[model samples]
Target chain A: MRSAFEWVDALPSSIALRESLNAYPTLLTTHVVSMCLFAGLIAFWDMRLVGLTLRKVPVSNIPTRLFPWALTGYGINLITGGLLLYSQPMRYYDNFYFWAKMALMAVAGFNMLWFHYATYKSVQAWDQGREIPMSARLAGVVSLVLWAGVVVTGRMMAYAGLMPEWWNNLNIGA
Target chain B: MTQSFFEWMQGLSFSAWMLEETWASPIIQCMHLLALVAFAGAVLVVDMRLLGRGLIKTSTARLARELDRWMIWSFVALFVTGAPQVLSTALKQYYSPFFWWKMQIIVIGLVFTFTIRRRVAFAEEGTLGHWPKVVGVLSIGIWTSVSVWARLIGLLS
Candidate 1:
């Protein structure tokens, strides 16, 4: 795994992206901006599922209407995030927070799949009702928590030094 | 006068603590980002409706009213978390052009969101013709600029 990352790190594109004066920040800004579109929409959808807000809007319409925009935001993040990782593979590979974010994202993905396949299959029966099923509501709560964790860990990646001495010592870069 | 104010803020005990405690700044920043997510979500809900995209079944006025609380509260959270971050490093922020630009854009965004955007959002649907769409686009652009300028504050200098 480490050798594979090293091979990618040595690539010209990765080095250029890492070394460029403007490209890195531009990518980062785009990533952050896109989050407003992606995560922002997802937050609303989750809230709706949990019966927090948007109760009047039919459950069926919410996902059908918002998923396209949310997916656009997700697509932007995937590309930018990929390039960011490509730019500094080893830096993220050694960072604990990076792995934490990846793990949270994986769990969040699984939660989405569960909601869509299992819970959402019966959404029609309760689409307009105020009372959401416990399973769907639980999925909403889990997703919200997981995504929040992803954001926290993602932000913390920059402050790796703030981690405990043991964690810092584990960093190969350190 | 502004420089003295910033200097005074930097001299405060709380500011000193924020600067001295390594965890304080990051924690506050994380709070700011979290607030950004909430606030942006609230804003997008309304703006997307205005653009004739999401929540098509619900009235735009109703959607705006429903999400208004989220927008206001989350913005307040953002402001509360953001102030300490600037206070901790007032002098450096005072010198950063990106910082000033972000502040100016934030002010513009707040004003635009409340006045023109709000009027358009809460206006009767289909009556405003293309105005809602225009306002929606402008609102998104303004808010997006706020995020961009905010990021540039740390990235540029």
Candidate 2:
């Protein structure tokens, strides 16, 4: 496992990105920008699903309307996040906050899947000017909390020093 | 003049507490990010309508009016939390290029949002020719710049 991280950190692209002064700032900026887009769009939809926003706007239309824009933002996030991880795989792998973020993201993904498979089919039936089903609202609430958790956890990663020295030092090689 | 103001702000008891308290900064930072979700989310929905892509069935005026409420409230919340964060790091922010850049973007974005975007969005449906589309594109561009620059201040600083 240590050798694997060493190899990733030693890769030509990683070295280039890690060595470049501008790469980090540029990537970090793009990463946040993507978050504003991705999380922002998701919030609108989730809020609607939770029966808090856009009540006049049909619930069925929210997902269809926002998916593309959200997807674009997600794509950008993936690229920038991948670059950041590539530059320092060991740092993230050892960080508790990073693991928390990934876990929350997995839960959010499942929540989305549950909505599409189980609840979304009945969306149009109770799409507008009425109470949303508990399942849909629950999914919406879960999505909101999980995505916000991801954001909070990502920021908390800066305090990754809370982890044990041996934990962070694992990839430095014996 | 500015030096004394910055010094005074940085020396404030609350600012000192914010700087020294490990939990304070991150909590305020989380508030800023959460407010951004509301502010930018509302903006994106309305902007998409302007661009004629999403929410095609919904009236632009209604979407704009409804979503603008969220945007404005979030802006106020963000400002409240953001002021302390800035004051805590007043001296550093005064000298930081990213801070000034974010200020510039926010000012310009406010102007555009209040004037052009608001007017066009509030106008009667089908009354404006191509102006709404242009305003939509401009709104997205300006807001994106503001968001990027605002977030960049933390990273670059």
Residue pairs that clash (backbone atoms under 3 angstroms), model 1: none
lDDT of model number 1 = 0.90
lDDT of 2 at B112: 91
Per-model tally of clashing residue pairs: 0, 0
TM-score list, all predictions: 0.97, 0.94
What are the runs in model 2 whose C-alpha is more than 4 Å off? A162-174
lDDT of 1 by residue, B1-157 (tens): 9999999999999999998898999889988998999999999989989998988889999999999999999999999999998999899889888888888988998999899988988888899989999999988998898899889888887
lDDT by residue (A48-155, candidate 2, tens digit) is 888887899988787788888899998999899989989988777677788788899898998889889989998778987578889889988999999999998888
lDDT (C-alpha, whole model) for all candidates: 0.90, 0.86
Docking class of 2: medium
Best by lDDT: 1
Misplaced by over 4 Å in model 1 are A164-174
Candidate 1: Cα lDDT at A81: 88
Give chain A TM for each model in order.
0.95, 0.90
